[model samples]
Target chain A: MCELLGMSANVPTDICFSFTGLMQRGGNTGPHRDGWGITFYEGKGFRNFKDPNPSCDSKIAELVQNYPIKSCAVISHIRQANRGAVNLENTHPFTRELWGRYWTFAHNGQLCDYQDLVTGRHRPVGQTDSELSFCWLLKQMEDKYPQPPQDMASVFKFIAQCCDKLREKGVFNMLLSDGEYVMTYCTNHLYWITRRAPFGKASLIDEDVEINFQEETTPNDVVSVIATQPLTDNEEWHRMKPGEFGLFHCGELADGNADQLIDVPFAEKKVKCQAPTEPLE
Target chain B: MCELLGMSANVPTDICFSFTGLMQRGGNTGPHRDGWGITFYEGKGFRNFKDPNPSCDSKIAELVQNYPIKSCAVISHIRQANRGAVNLENTHPFTRELWGRYWTFAHNGQLCDYQDLVTGRHRPVGQTDSELSFCWLLKQMEDKYPQPPQDMASVFKFIAQCCDKLREKGVFNMLLSDGEYVMTYCTNHLYWITRRAPFGKASLIDEDVEINFQEETTPNDVVSVIATQPLTDNEEWHRMKPGEFGLFHCGELADGNADQLIDVPFAEKKVKCQAPTEPLE
Candidate 1:
């Protein structure tokens, strides 16, 4: 299993605060030390930084930590090798171009028999189950809708259905974005927190750092962060139940099913159905 | 017009030396001050760093110049905007994945009436003639060959034909790579130099930096550098002709027609055929 972190904000915002806490978990506080990657979406353009080295010690990671790149949407991951080798190719936060928009994805769980999923135009550059699943999901979308739907509700619902199917194989916690909206699907462990006006100070759980949101953000700003575990101890984080899917657009929940959290009772059964490829460390 | 830089090596080599010179041209010594980008290929995986800010003052560019990210192939560009606004979306050195391999491209010239070119599956995210041409070229390849060609000679010929067609619109000097080979098509100003064993000292034309290659390189290292203009004053760089197309694999010329140097008469005719959208600055 791996760790995932994501952010969406009404205004351009940096992830240095939450990223600092998450970087500690990459190798210092947690066991996800195989590799790490992050993608930042700025309008229709985006850039990604990845390292095969552990985030705690990677020089590139250090540069990212110091540099404040503001973006509306961001997705990051720290990996623990399971199905693929620990190399640059298998680093998380995979990206592909679809419908003239760049789509980015990162997965946290291993899927059994994922190769059965047929891929269309999009193919995986890395030999990882996460990348294969991403390619299949995009291909499915490309085949279903030749053009982007006028209403995004149908797209969100269709993606949720795909997530439910993948959950049947094993854990399928995922974070995906196409520079416009962020879609997160939870299977086991996922939490999110939204900060708006009247924000207060928050202290990180893994790092000895405190940030006052009110001082850094404008009153109209709305920012939301999603991660495998709550980065801060003071803030009230919402934990998603199994088989729950949510979509965020400009830091606000956009999907109609946002409140209707589905509690699909397939977590334990799916774990037993598929033989573990490698024992969870 | 823009400035292009590329590198191909038999072993994983860092382009910091050549990149330092190019960085100076991005804003300090040249007029290409709109944006800059670079891509580094590490085996089957690659990562890119791009900034809308001028490279001379860009913190990211400074970091890139200081950090030595070794790669077998690299493509970089400094933009002087002509058809598109100076923004991150229009930054050059765009990348897309095809046949499970990453393809990167950077153009050094403008196209006239290029919007008429019909793009198939691949589409340009930014409204730039350079990106539009790249997408069209890739889409053409994707349409002509579903899978990677077994024999690469035909593919090279097909790409050269595509370059000729693009040159019909206007200047189309470009640098492209698909992780395996670095292809350069010169429609105007493009120069290349290969350095092997018995290396000597080279001094940058833009910066006052000098590097003694003999002290840093091993005997088996074979590295080639390509740029819009000669980067080093002392090096014997080969200036490509208008319709000349060359392919480098593992730092050596792979295409048999590399020495043929076809000087197609389309250069003078094409300039008069298409009405220039923006005057040459």
Candidate 2:
């Protein structure tokens, strides 16, 4: 088991403050002390760091606490080690090249017998079922589309079905990005928040940390963050249904289909958007 | 502070067991409670889920405890909000576009006077300094390369400088990735573990979860996970030092530097990682 943190925004930003508070729980306020890691997206590149130590005590963690490596998107994790060893190779926010683009992913669940499903050019680096499951998901996607999909909704639907079947083994809460859009699925635990023109003050439940967005952001900034648990103490959070999924692009809801957010019939929840050329009041 | 969870492997994997244990800490075993999210990678596509609720109590979290989504590199977060409202927009593990690639980020620290340092194409979406810093990092990189780095090491070095400057802001433990490589920096709190051919059983420190990778993975498999804390109870975790950065690619160190592990120069260790075309020996 581990802790998860991520960010998706219209602009480049840092997770320093939030991460600082979160780090306290990694070992000090909490007990995920098996290992820790973080990934920051700097354009086409990545600023990733990890260690087989607790965030609370790791000297590197202190550096992270003090640094402000900014990026538009970020994915981070702290482990409690359930399916893998405490080593640098087993750390998360795994990366792979597909369709000529880099894709990043993170999960917060376990699979029972996922190893049997892996089959393809891609393979697992470590021995965690989490990694095996990643291989299978990618294999299936590659099978469905040799290149990137033009219609994100269709692409997400296909993966949703795949995830639906994977649920048979165990939980699967995950985050994914192709440096363009972030697609998320909630088979179990997942939560999100969207910050826009009207910003506010927020506090951490795990640590005594708080910040006000109005003081740090512009009126045009729009950002959305997702994680395995709520990070703030004073705001209201919407809980994703057990079987739910969503997409974010440029800090807005890319997948406007309610079917992905609830158990409503796919047909009932489907909400297609008109092409940009055809949009008008 | 919040928690972060990540997994990088040669094969696809689902972080069910690890996430489950982490979820308990979201609002039960731990204090993170602003929002939650996760992303799964499927070849060139992605599946993501986000909710503005605590992972421990949200029914969606229950589903993730049961479902099984997988990916090679996965990032998840449980927030204790500090910048934006406890809504869907302020969660961590944000994603954005850069040079036609998808980037993801997650942070665990704070930054002062960061607003002045970060100013460019990448901007904050939410109110957290983490998102602002992410934007600043991306802006700097995008400006620096215009194109990707000539090599992984150069890119790592560039990012390392960025991390260094940001570290001066306060705390900046972070993770960044571009699907090809996962790079991380330890400003305050970060840690990771690598699971390889010789896998072993690991137990959760915060929840009742356990798994034996040796029983499920092939010897060729190499999986790495990074987080803010150790994910297992029975394991030796390495501490990442301050002012340290590492890269994980294909479940191995890309920098090819083994000395990255002993990076803790001083200041209580924060996080910890390596590669090379030119063989060291």
Candidate 3:
């Protein structure tokens, strides 16, 4: 139905090269041409952009193609209409603020009987289930704790509970962030790759372009990227099990081995985007 | 154009409440209704979702409304058409591979003469400039070095140079990551907020919802959120200047003083997503 792309790192890095390659999939090579948007984080600040045009033709998208916005954390999305019409209000990558901090979110799966989840306390601006889920999440957070968590461990435990509850309903693969850390969960298909020192050429699967990070980064650099699918054919992208979740902060897993991982088939390692609508398989 | 939402933190916390406010803009409150997507950095990997449907009404969006996906780093987006036809291939958030890592990206503005940016080596799957820009960035990375950078400083510098160069052409605001670090550039509207122990009640600009993070989070948490616009009306938001570019690492600006701020009014701060297609007034 659509595609997702994200990154978390220990050092600052630009994602222009990789982003450009993924953009090709929106009506250029693939079919996710409903709309698109991106977010870049800076020290307590950020840069963001969006366009309802296909990544293959949006002039604004072209400008982004030519620019190299860098950050420690990044998230992006492209849409392929399934349940709604293509428009500005229906694009992906929703955001909100909590505990004096801003939180970003994106999803790639569909659910049954989601209307039951919508609450008046947090209403949906648009009509998409993705945004509705975002609202529902906020309500739960407020309901669970009137204030922020006491520590990282406690917060993670609370979030873990939330995710488990959501997964039980349907495919709940998704991403969440507070700019300092990233939390990702997969119910159907998800993949990831980490980049550290000694970077090398990486060819884009959607485009015939490649980049050599070694020449452009220092030894202190540690970057990681994630997506609904494998962005490159040659790279090793790990797929999440049917029900799995993980957290990323500063280029590493923040859960600190708290979340369990399942032994997945190596063949499943091949990454690809997910469909918000349930697959007919 | 699309919308972007992000968050960062020093301690783990759920983004449900904040995400709820932002999701309201997905289709119910705002105009960006093309499609919706989001990413939650869960430990080492990311949980992402993309819907070809309006996030406002999508069932998955509804689940997100109620689900509390916790994360330290998060990114989200909502789309409005400008390039590719309405479909799944032309959504905003796009992912790829580079330097042996998954690179995720999303865009908002438009560019001119971007066709020249697309290379046969990195052909685009979408029809938007956003994807082409991603390819071009990858091309530069590949041509500049044979591998990933060994020095973090050198990589950041080069990326900044590239971003600055693109800013000269038009609005190139972008967000990207390889999972270890995040890179961001601003040519238009962008803002961020940091949240710590003293959380407060924040309301969404688009929807009739409010949350008191102080009631939900503890003092040890340091969370940050970035966006194209401030989701709430009461809080303060710092906007990016024209042609100003920078990065975010560890939920903060990569550069201690990346931009030399000048006295400007809010009127000048508004940079529409179509920077390349439309000149700044």
Candidate 4:
């Protein structure tokens, strides 16, 4: 098992504060010390920094923690290495291009017999079960829709269906994004917190650092962070229930209530995946 | 246009010395100030570092220069951004996984009417003639052989054939690799130099730096570097002729002489692409 971290913001925001807390767990506060990786999306573009070294002493991790790379969507992971060897290729936060958009994924749980998932368009370069699962998911999406679908709700439903099937094998908490939307599926131990106008000071649980959101942002700015464990001790983080799938867009949940998975006719799930205020491409 | 740099070595070697010279061209010594990126291959594993900011002053670039991440193969680029916007998406040294191997590419020249080269299975996530050309080439390879072909020489011939076609569009100088081999195609400007046993001192042309290879390398080390121009002022670099495609493996030219390309019957090309010592996987 490993740890996962993600962020979605209304404006281009950095994860330096949260990442600082997480790095401590990579051999310091915890034992997820195999490797760590992070991806930051800037508009339709993103930059990924990964190292097979322990994050606590990695020079690249130090740079990432210092550099305030602003992004609307971000996904990160620290691996403990179960299925794959500790190597750069097996590092977490894998990325592949789909529908002319870069899709990034990070998984926090182990799976058994993942080779059963047949892949077509996308294939894994690494030996990790996490990468194979990511490729399997993308292959399913590409097979289902050769192009971007107009109805995103159906796509999410299809993804959830696949996740449900994957969970039957083992734990399957995950964080996936396409630079615009972050879809988080939790099978166990996931939490999220949204900070908006009434932002306040928060202290990190792992590190002895504190930041005042009031000084760091404007009143209109909204940011949401999701992690395997809560990074801040003072903030009221929402603990997600098992089997819950949540979609976040611009620092807010697209689904009003993320607790229920209602069974509906395939044709009735026509809710557009894009925000109502934004025009479809 | 951009500046391309690549390395193929028999042993895992650090490129900090050569990269120190190349990064200077990103802005300090040349006009390629848009962005820069590099991919280092460690066995079957690889790590990529990219930045949209000028490499000369980039913090990430600084770290890459100071840190010595050793690898057997490397591909790097510094962009001037003629066809696409100066952004992270348009950064060079694009990567894609095929045949369970990561195919990395970096182009130093521009192409006209590149959109006409249709792509299938593989597509460009970034808007650049370079990336589109890479996708088109990969699609052609996948179409020709679904799996890793036993005859790699034929694959190189096919790649050269594709390069011959792409060259008709415009300047198409490029460097491509699959972790083991480095394929260089020249149209406008490209140079290479192989340094082995009798190592000598070398001085950089762009930056005020000098290194005596005798103190840095072992007698058995054989390393080859390909670049748009001779990086060091002291070394004698061979200038590749227009329309020439060269294949390098284990720091030596796989093709005995890279000066000529003969039109051979499709079925007659049976030269294996891998090093003689390496077993086919």
Determine which window of 10 residues in candidate 4 chain B has minimal summed lDDT. Answer: B272-281
Worst 10 residues of 4 chain A by lDDT: A272-281
**CAPRI grade of model 3:** incorrect
Poorly placed runs, candidate 3 (over 4 Å): A256-281, B1-281
Put down candidate 2 lDDT per residue, A83-159, tens digits, no spaces: 97765556676766555445677778887877678545455656677666776787898899876666555666677
Best by lDDT: 4
How accurate locally, in lDDT, is each candidate?
Answer: 0.83, 0.68, 0.65, 0.84
In the order shown, the chain A TM-scores of the predictions are 0.90, 0.87, 0.87, 0.91
TM-score of chain B of each: 0.90, 0.86, 0.83, 0.91
Model 1 docking category: acceptable
User: Candidate 1, after superposition: displacement of residue B35 in Å?
Assistant: 0.6
Error of 4 at A230 (Å): 0.5
How big is the positional error of residue B117 in model 4, measured in Å on the Cα after superposition?
1.0
Task: State residue A268's C-alpha deviation in candidate 3, in Å.
Answer: 34
> For candidate 3, what is the DockQ?
0.02
Task: Choose 1 or 3, whichever is better by DockQ.
Answer: 1
- Predicted candidate 2 versus true structure: per-residue lDDT over B64-107, tens digit per residue: 56655545767778888766676444677776655544577888
Worst 10 residues of 2 chain A by lDDT: A272-281
> Ranking under DockQ, best-scoring first?
4, 1, 2, 3
RMSD of each candidate?
Answer: 10.3, 18.9, 23.0, 5.6
Backbone-clash count (model 4): 0
DockQ head-to-head 1 vs 4, winner: 4
For model 3, residues A233-264, the per-residue Cα lDDT tens digits are: 87788787776677777776554334432232
DockQ of the two-chain complex in candidate 2 = 0.02
